[model samples]
Target: MRRRKRRFLFSTVCTLFILLAGLAGAALFFRIQGKIGASRKTPDALFLEYVECLSKADYTDMYRMLDEQSHLNISEEDFITRHKNIYEGIEASGITAQIGQVAEKDGEAVVSYNMSLGSIAGEINFSNQVKFRKEKKKGYQMVWDDSVIFPELGRSDKVRVSTDKAKRGSVFDRNGLLLAGKGTASSVGLVPGKMSEDSAGDLETLGNLLGISADAIGKKLSAKWVKEDSFVPLKTIKKVDELNLNSMEPREDNVKNKEFQDELLAVPGVLITDTEVRYYPLGESGAHLVGYVQNVTAEDLEKHSGEDYLSDSVIGRSGMEALFEKELKGTNGRTITITDSYGTVKKTLAAKPRVDGKDITLTIDSTLQDEIYQTFKEDKSCTVAMNPYTGEVLALVSTPSYDDNDFILGMSEEKWASLNDDERKPMFNRFRQRFAPGSSFKPITGAIGLSTGAIDPNEDFGGEGLSWRKDESWGNYYVTTLHDYSPVILENAFIYSDNIYFAKAALKIGYDDFMSGLDKLGFNQEIPFDISVTKSQYSNTERIETEVQLADSGYGQGQMLVNPIHLASLYTMFANQGNVMKPYLQYKEEPKSEVWLPGACSSEIADRIQTALGKVISSEHGTGHAAYRNDIEFAGKTGTAEIKASKDDRTGTELGWFAVFTTDPNLETPILLVSMTEDVKDRGGSGYVVRKDKAILNSYISGGR
Candidate 1:
């Protein structure tokens, strides 16, 4: 009886402990639930959560937060479409939200909020109110509407950005021949949402037909989470005629479709759109001069943030196109509009018309340019021709060259790599490279000697020797070599290109006067022109410690460097009566013809030099006699500059050079030609350079076609 009573008492105490514990657990659970419920009902907290969903483009979450009335009014698809449209139009880079105040109206709670979206243009700010309704199970459901986007937006209105693409200006040669201009091309595109998993094989087939990787196609088609209406471009065919439907084949599993044309079109949402593309009509001939354009990058959009430039805008990459990019790129226009959910324009709010870019004309003659380009197609050489009197560039040629059309039409990776890695450097502009002038510089030496009264027109020097140097006091520091002509006079020295005579003439001209004369002739000075040219180089007499260096420089042997453009321009002094006209490319500017200081000699001295140079083509003994023609009376000089393989090496490469000019009395167009060639295989020496000059001059004389 005692044991039973003890057991009953123990059971009673245990029951009481269990009951107390259950009551405490119930109280704790209710306390936790109340905190969570209050937190969910907080207007600021709920509004902030909704704002975060919009910023991340979580349309599903945003739609779930809407009240029963909003869900009944707007479908999930339409809601997502509306959000995407606004996001894409603004191209928002970032977003920010702030809850300002909460108030009660008509027994309903409303929260005021400020939202800001960052874009390329700047920040867009909007102030609006979000209504909330309390309900069972759902703490605070949003009474969502279009007014949440902007206070001005109504039930039927939507925000949109309308872009008005501007027309890029055309590029033309001096003769108004179109080089680069706007044209249309066919573009292949894909819509991701329409491409079902079963139809994904179509992309691989289309990729094969387009000569592109299937993976690349897939990446472009599904670049990011996109709407069903989003169109993504796979490739653009600039030359539609080159597309071959017969070459494209479908998969074995797709028996109904025989070719890629039918196979790709059978895929839902596949499309072909006509797109504007930059065209190069002149092809590779004027490629370097005209350059090409490419689509703008993210960095470019950021750099031009203040302007109306978008990521789709085109920018110049090189050559003259890059040099004048601002003038070539027109001002883009914009239109802000209100649209319906289906993207149908309800009203055009405001718009600004685009301004077309200005057209630019160069001074290059197409006919002459084509001839020069073709002639140097196989040769590693450079040639520059200009109107000596007016300084108008007639032709500028550098080879081996790539077709500019290749860049405009879209170059292959293999082709671009090949061009960049070529040993001959086809893309390099050889015309602007600096090299030794050799015997072609003899005229400058003669002019300086004559102007400084160092050489008399009748004064005779012994050109009969193959070598020359100063007296023993100079310790035979150096001996300059030349072609020996027995008892050569100054005129014969000029005709025969006697190096010994010129070496002696430099001694008489004095080192100081010689250096001054070179400086006057525009050596080492910046040349003013549309294209940049390197300054001519010569050794400073102050830096020269030996008499041999002076003698070598006198005959264009030591430390002398010049470019074809400036060399041709330098010869203009002879044709223009001692006036060195400034080289120009634009036709609008008035001609700048004035004598360059220190280099321009007296009229009498110019006449004397002209008389001597004329013998170079007229006289039988002249070195440049090969350049003479029956219809063309011309004067010029020839040179073979020595290129040492090593600095200390005695002998190596021979760079041939020719500088010539002719006066057309009928048109007053004095033509000057300067050419330089690398070490050619079969053709060697100045004679080869002269032969090329003859061919080029003959074309000009025969009406320049």
Candidate 2:
């Protein structure tokens, strides 16, 4: 028993001692590991820290990681500034790195590194060596130099960047007529050295010819880089081609500019030279359709951060230019070169090939577009001309417009102010806008009435004078018409433009049927066109809350607003067997027709309305009789939209509208023209617009676009 107890005690003591030894070993190992972790980085690690700092553009930290010798050679400010100037100038971002082999010799080392940087020239990649020197006190530190920033860069070398501008694509009409394209303009400049001894008089003459003030010319000449012999461009004037109507260039404007150019040549120190320019050949005739491009502002660059745009880049501002900007603006090329103090290229760092913009061909007929613009340029008007069968838009014109070329050539402050300040709202794009469609909307209402089976074409709504209301429940407001015609059938109402007949038809259709009818006709829907316009709506709200509002909506009053393009599309149903054609701007081969609303009305109903439309133009007593032509059979409707604060208030302006098309689709070029003019209240109302469009129709039918 004594031997067993003594053995057990010895075994327990041995186990305890062994356990304590194992714990001591673990503690010692942990202490050694902590020391390793807390110690200064290895030579390769220090270089990696420098590179990681470089990736983040942390120049201050990177400078701190340099050795004493490097610090003595360059100040922290200089180091940071150099890195920032080169990196930011090239728009560098998205840096990635890969560390290669590190070979050490004695106390110094060279760590191989491969880095990638995203820049305007695309991805820049290079493999280089980073030097590390073992310091007396700081351990391993980087040896900093300009070469660390870029392998091709030396201490005194500068990085020179050059941009190759891509050729902007031309815009053409369906017949290959140039709309917006490349052209040359006269660049009027002044050379200080060539000035007369009486330089004051010479400056005055030069300023007058260039349409600039003497002080403005003086300011330009006083620029920091302007030398005595330097030719400082003052302005660019439009050049005209007599044979080119496609450019929509106004002959008078060009002639005036030519006279100025000639007079400028007579002035001492003045130089007139040709320079390439982006031109809207259509000028004021199609200004609202083609749009213009201008130099990029700081705001544009900030908004499009990662885009390819540079400080001096040009961007589309409005119209077709803005609509197709992405495809129309080609990629610009760039080259980054290392240059010496004298600006001689030492090495090429990176380069990119230029990509030219794609050309655009529109379905528009420039001849027709110009003609329509000329007719309405004196007034606030909007017009849309299209081919009813093919759904191809031929012309979109908004008048009281500014020359688009003025934007590219630099418009005067006075001209710009006049446009904005004009109560006519010339800057307001009418074709791209919505308006109270007036009586032109009647055809649509009539078709909707027939489609819903709420209207009988032959049934008489009887005589109700010139104005009417749904019932006594509707107070004050009444549906009004211009003419009171007897036996008011659908066709007869169309001929006389009787609003009461259509109003009664709408009341029978009721609210639910009317709203549903509007939905089928593409109300509250985005029209599938390249350029966006506000959707057509019967009312601002979804539901019709009153009988009077519904009655007014039937005659294209109340809140019945529509886009000219959409209104033109609605008319296509009359010519296309009850199908609303989808209007397209971009030209396609074969000119295929696309149905936007299939069976908006029945074929028989479309024919009945179409026949009534023809009679509206042909009948002697018709409101649209002013546009009757002996050469071509025409079909059309006239509308006068009353803009009133109330039914009793007669001081509001009126919108004159005329929607017309040819009955002969077999003609070489079938056209549907819809025009609307503002402030036509006392100016013959819809007749004013009808007369203006008559000339266009006559010119079109006579092959005189």
Candidate 3:
């Protein structure tokens, strides 16, 4: 009876103790849950604290709070370089943050804050999400996400940027024909970070479709690892026509599957951007003048930064495009919008509009330009045609030209090599380089003698062969064609290109007076034009002894150098009644803000020169009789300057030249033309050909064809 009683009492006590312990454990669990819930609700406070720490440059604390992946990917050095400058100002401004609200969705928390940094104040709404995962040894620790969202600041005085879209300007010729303008070009760009590694094969396949190599695709795919921003472009494949993209073949087996195709479509990296490209209609003909446009390079970006100017996109490389770059380049603008972490549009914060560039119309006549090109194409040469009355360039041609379209897109190594290797030097603008003016300068010298009253039109110096007493080694010791010959008049001297007659005239006029004539004729002065011009140089020495030296100078030789344009302008004085117009390229109706006035010479002197030049072509012994015709009374002079020939030596090659001016009393306009050629042999008169084709082309203009 006693044992039974003891067993029953012990069992009842044990059961009561067990029930009490179970109730206590449940209460402790409820308390812990309440603390966690309270902490989650205070996300706004946590975000503000975190921002405050960042404002103070407490990067260690910031790093500790970041999610595992972000922590591993970003280093302290990288973070500092990226945000140090921006955050330094924020920290120095004694900024404070105020939490607005906290919300939770899809296992993440978001908080909004009003931030003030110095006098510059703005609102910043951000998300603070904690990721919890169990560890092997310890309890769970919180990992904070780095992504942040900002509220719209609206229009502010702190920043003023353009928000308007840039409408590219049009490029037109002097005749208002379009040469190059903005056009739509198809392109494919890659954002390597947003692309999946498994998509590498698909990218290669796509590259092949776009006519790019597999290696290029792989390089683009690996480019993102070096970038701070995930959206930067790795590569852009251009000239993607409609046929290519529509015919894309799916090499990836998964891509062929409909479900997988839909997934691939959701990939974020592959994109098409609407951008402007320069297009040339004339292509090769005016390539040097209109030039070409291309993408901005690293060098360009570095050269033009932080200025209120156009972004580094297209630039004029040469010709008119290069000369008037400032006028042609317009201002570019940008528009920005605020968005949430999910890329949902929160609001449009600011906008700016872009301005279109001005259109430039040149003084170039397309027909004349074509003529010049055709003429020079027959032989390697250059030509420049201008309107004497206005100094407006009608045509400028350099043969063996290149197509600007090649530069517009991009030149391959081979094409560049070919251009660089050409012997004709097609890239060089010969119209701007100096060459021997030859006999073409004779009329100007004759004019100087007449203007200065050093010689009379009727008066003559004997035109017998020239002879020098001091220097006769080169056979310059010849006597007169006729002993005690009749006086050589100015007309006789000019028509025959008599070396002795002009030498006597130059000596009588004196070197000072002769050089003064050259100055009045615009020598050694910048040829007022849009394009560059080479200034001609003439040697004027006080002493003369050698017969060959006198002979050379009288016939437009002996260190006389003039550009093609210079010679044309010089001849224009006769045609335009001694009024020299300032050369211009940009035209009216699309006029530049500035205008150049004409340069005038002495009319009296000009008429005398015209008379002499006329007699040279019309007279029976005229040197340029080959250029005369029946339609109009054309006057000209031919020159053959000996190269590599000394004052004593008579042997060497000759540079042939011809300058002419034609007029009709019935017509209002007069035409002036100058042509020159180098390295001709095996013909009469210095064994050279004067490129008669140039005269043939000029005839068309004079004939109004």
Candidate 4:
């Protein structure tokens, strides 16, 4: 009886403890639930949650948040897809939403908010209100519609970006002659209605000829927008007639292309049509300068990701075409609108006005450019012509060039291979490169010597024969000149192009002063021009180390290298009466003379050098006398740069140079032309280049240019 009483008391205490613990657990659970329920469930808060989903681009989550009315209008799958396509299509990002205020109307809660986002066209911002309704089953829920995605959008409206593509500006020469402009190209396409019944074989043939898959073509034909009579353009090709102009028969590859097209045309709806394309009017003559444009590639799109570039857009590939790509490419206009089911625009969300490309007018004279290009088109050469007084670059020519139009129209694989395999390297832009200026560099040395007082205009340096070495430190190397003259004064040195005289003069200028004077003349400095030309360099190293190196430099040989344009610009010092005029290619303002390198020479020294250079063309036995014209006074110099293994080596090739300018300032065409050619050995040396320049000058002077 005693044990039973003890057990019953223990059970009573344990039951009391369990009942108290259960009561406390119930209280804690209710408190947690109350805290969650206490959080704002107002219309503003619920709408903010919906906006939060939009900011994250969580379309599926957004679809679930929509009210029953919205679900009734659009299915869950279509709601998600529409939002995704519209957002991704415009490349939208950085979405933000801020709640402004809340109001109640007609028993419904309206929350006002301002939203903003970024897109490819620009920023898009709007103010809108979202409504929340009280439902019997779900106490409160946010109401949504197409207008919620974008203000003014309707249930039946379509959201899309309409692009108004800007026309690419044309490139014109000084006289308004077109260098690069718009033209027409051939497009290969098919008419769906005329397609063969058994198109499997026909499509295979067409696909192979067009260099695309048959499945791809089939998909294009089956597109909803493509009707039976619709013409489905497949590929763009070169204008057949233009590509085969010079030849009586089409090229082997062209014949193959034509035959392929003919076979396809016989089978089905295949046809050739015309489409607009970019044309290079100057063709091979202005190829290097005008360059060419091609369709943008994936890499191009990435490189210019934030710019107004479309996959089908073209970008400048070379020459001035590339240099001024930004200025030439216009801003494309865009309109994001809401359209109805009938394709009628209902409302515009955002719009950007289109700005057409700026038409670029250059200082290049097409006639002069073409004339100069024709003179050396068959040789490895480069030439630059400019108005010496004004520093306007009139023409820039590089020989053995490829047709830039061919690049735009389309070039065959075999043709591309031939261009690469040709020893001439037609695609190389020679005018933009630097080369040993040879004797053409003599006038710069003369100016340096005369301005630095290292050389007196009339001071005689006695006789040193045709070859002389300073103290025999040069070993077998000796400064040699073609003509032996007595009294090596500045006049005789320039007239005869005496290497020994200039070499001795360079030694007189010493290393420091020579470099300083050269710097003053724009050497080792960036040339300010539209095109990028390599800087003229005096030596490979910072200093002219040895006596032979210094001597050779004085004659424009040694390790000296100069850009053709830079060389042409340097001569402006004489024409401008002591200032190196800044060279320019754009025709923005009046033709004004701007000095590039001031104080390059004193006026007196310039006149003296100018007279001496004139004698170089007029005086009998003068090195440049062969180019003399009785009607016009020409000042010029000739140079033969020897490329030898050693000072005694004679088998090396030679580079010929001729730099000439008209002394007559009042002359209708005052041009300073510089021409250089490789492998001038035994072919009249620098005289060969001189003769070539003379003809171009005569043609230009006679108004042919």
Q: Estimate each model's TM-score.
A: 0.69, 0.88, 0.62, 0.85
Q: Would you list the C-alpha lDDT of every candidate in the order shown?
A: 0.75, 0.87, 0.58, 0.85
Error of 3 at 343 (Å): 4.7
lDDT of 2 by residue, 146-212 (tens): 8887787889999777899887788999999999889888788989898889887888877765668
Candidate number that wins on lDDT, 3 or 4: 4
For lDDT, the strongest prediction is: 2
Candidate with top TM-score is: 2
Tell me the tens digit of each residue's lDDT in model 4 across 416-473. Answer: 9999999989988899898888777888888888877888778898788878888856
- Steric clash pairs (candidate 3): 162-352, 163-351, 163-352, 163-353, 164-352, 164-353, 164-354, 460-488, 461-488, 464-481
> CA RMSD for every model?
13.4, 5.0, 19.6, 6.5
Task: List the candidate 4 regions with Cα displacement exceeding 4 Å.
Answer: 1-38, 45-53, 56-80, 93-101, 104-108, 114-127, 133-141, 187-272, 703-705
Off by over 4 Å in 2: 1-40, 208-213, 223-228, 239-255, 258-266, 340-346, 465-467, 475-478, 482-486, 703-705
Give the CA lDDT, 0 to 100, for residue 185 in model 3: 44
Rank by lDDT, highest first: 2, 4, 1, 3
Better of 1 and 3 by TM-score: 1
User: How many steric clashes between backbone atoms does each model show?
Assistant: 2, 4, 10, 1
Winner on TM-score between 2 and 4 is: 2
Candidate 3 lDDT trough over 10 residues, lowest sum: 153-162
Inter-residue clash pairs, candidate 1:
284-403, 284-404
lDDT of 4 at 566: 94
